[model samples]
Target: MTEQRSSPTTSGTTASTGDDGGARTGVAALVLLAACTALAQGLARYSFGPLLLPMREDVIRSYAIGGLLATVHMAGYLVGAVAGVRASARVAPLWLIRTGMAGSVAGLAVLSFSTGSAMVGAGLFLTGMGGALVWLAAPAVAVQVYPCDPGRAIAIIASSMGIGITLGSVVPALVPAVGGWRAVWGIEAVSVLVVLCVSLLLLGSRPQVSARAEESGGWRPDRRWIWTVVAFAAFSFGIGTGMTFFVAALRDGAGWTVRRAGATYSMIGVAMIAGGVIAERLSRSLGRMPVLVAQFVLAAASMFMVATGMGPVVSVAAVIIGTTMSGTAAVVSADLHDRYSPQQMAAAFGLMLIPLGIGQMLGPTAGGWAVDLAGDPFTAFMLCGAVMGAGLLPLVIHGCRRTRRAQTPLITGR
Candidate 1:
């Protein structure tokens, strides 16, 4: 396949060069952006999961309140996702990236000093907004830096979130040594600040046009794109429920120790780091649509395994879910890039994420209710699998239509 080149007007001076130095700079910029993504998506957002119990002990006493705080964070993410669509139309992607990073830093700093549930909830809300903004805008910047290979660039950014989640999982272990949960937040704040500064230096204030704007011809959402967004929401719903209940299922249903369950859960994060790379390679070899379909099937199968409550099989299921969850999103984004103009990509992607945010907000609560009603976490797991299976219908239909359209010319020519 011929690599698509971004027009100079769209990509700015940095993307116009094919020299070795240009490539090095682009790589460096992408790495820095990936680091920002790690902090925003990984640490700032996920560190809450590990820190929640300790935070409850120190300030918030009720698990219900803690759960409510998480919901507030998701609400903020939904708001940010909506804002990102409008923000992309009025500002540069780099501006969105930097501003989002600043929000994460501020939220983390707030969490470090929070003494009450309200304060912690506020901090989480800020972090959620920041995370969503960064995620929505970073791909646009990635396309600018690596115009010829936006898929790879996006994969790097997506995979880096796994690194953050893995590191966040380790934060609880540091609570005693760090003096408290608050101190862990302090350290994370400093870490995010360091990355933010480096990103500012690496990506200067030069204005670049939207990625592929010249070739996009002002793209708008059609039936296919709308279907893609719905599929994305279903994907989010399935993964959110699965992740929310994964460790609980192992510990409560399979009679595993807390340590053992957490260790098994960490495997998901570790596998996620490799998910994007694996997906990109497979998409290159097998084609994006086929790879995407295979990922969903694997995810559904893995969820079924978890529902079985077989300890060994559940371990394998965790790994499979980790590998395919992020991988599916990467493939979906790359597929969307095939259709959207650079100028529209950020807004379009952000619009798609709104449903994902809603799904995330609803999935865990619904899963918890299902478990309560059925008196078994396994039932909820089965429901997650069913949701994913249902999600596959739209993608299959869209893919079949796409294939038929591609073949029509050959048939008519004959």
Candidate 2:
């Protein structure tokens, strides 16, 4: 049985009865979703890069242990994705996201007082789990509510990560007076609470969707989708590994001061904002697959530039890498929208993220070891570039096969 949902005011459309009201609601929802994402992912996940060095100097001991904490965080995200997929039937996505935001606040609080690696890791894990729920629900709601222009909606929400990343780094870099990673967590927790309040006010009501199974068939991904999943995993591995260590790369490899490194890292946020907009426009004009392929190549090139450790080159590469990373969602979501039904998208997207989570989990570990081996971040940067470039091979094969199939149909007709 297929489920159907209708809002009393909006019915059959994302907007309400009045044109102005509908526009207001959509704008409000997008803005709120973006803020929520900034809090959930930007602060919760990406903040670690800026905070890690401080924690290491003050309390933590080993780089491997710190990286392992990030790995555990991704593990938590993996679990949360699986849980969200199962629970989506019973729970409203809006409520779930609110709950997740609350969890993030609590996790940050735990981090503020953590005395050991184990506690720190646990806090990060909690934060990641909460972030997964918020991240999943935010885009799902945006796409669900704004079906007419889902790509744009997704782009806006995804761009918030950059906003968050920028803030996460800038705040601490600017406020050395506060001192220590603990203050960063505490301040972020407060900020997240504020966003949560605004999000609750803006998105209090849930879209009415009848919870019904469309098919008895279990979720089974085909071969092409499997490759797509692998591609995403590989791409994410590079992003996860590189971004996780970006500040460290600048400080350790390039002989940059902590403040300078943090300041430079904010450029990523600027790039991300620009990239999301550019990706949306490019995907519409150039096609999603082409954009995806080009992004991977560009990301690889940027990572290679970062490996040079020249201040100017690394700074420029940071923007390019950030742009490429943030644009990933634009192509993936656009392509998936073409392939999957609205109902299936939520579940399918959730499932695909499992591999991404796995890649995220391993990325930090491998990158940290590489850094250790080289006694600098050069090897880690190159590893990210190599992995990102390697992802292109599978995508190219998929594209070639698709082209051949299209030609075969025309040949048969002829």
Top TM-score model: 2
**What TM value does model 2 have?**
0.92
**Residues 295-392 of candidate 1: C-alpha lDDT, one tens digit per residue:** 88888889899887777888899888878866876777776666555655555677788988887767666776777777786776888788878877
Which parts of model 2 have CA positions greater than 4 angstroms off?
A: 1-18, 206-208, 215-220, 408-414
All candidates: CA RMSD in angstroms? Answer: 3.1, 3.5
Candidate 2's residue-wise lDDT over 1-414, tens digit each?
122432222322334525766667777777888888888887677888888788888766666777788898888888777777777766667877888898898889888888988888888888888888887777767776565577888888777788888888776563476776788788888889888988777677736344555411355677767777877888888888877788877777888898888877888887887787688779877777778878878888888888887878878988887787678776676666566655566667777778888888888899888888778777877998888778778877998898788799789997
Q: After superposition, how far is residue 407 of candidate 1 from its true place, in Å?
A: 5.3
RMSD of 1: 3.1
Each candidate structure's count of clashing pairs: 0, 0
How big is the positional error of residue 207 in model 1, measured in Å on the Cα after superposition?
5.3
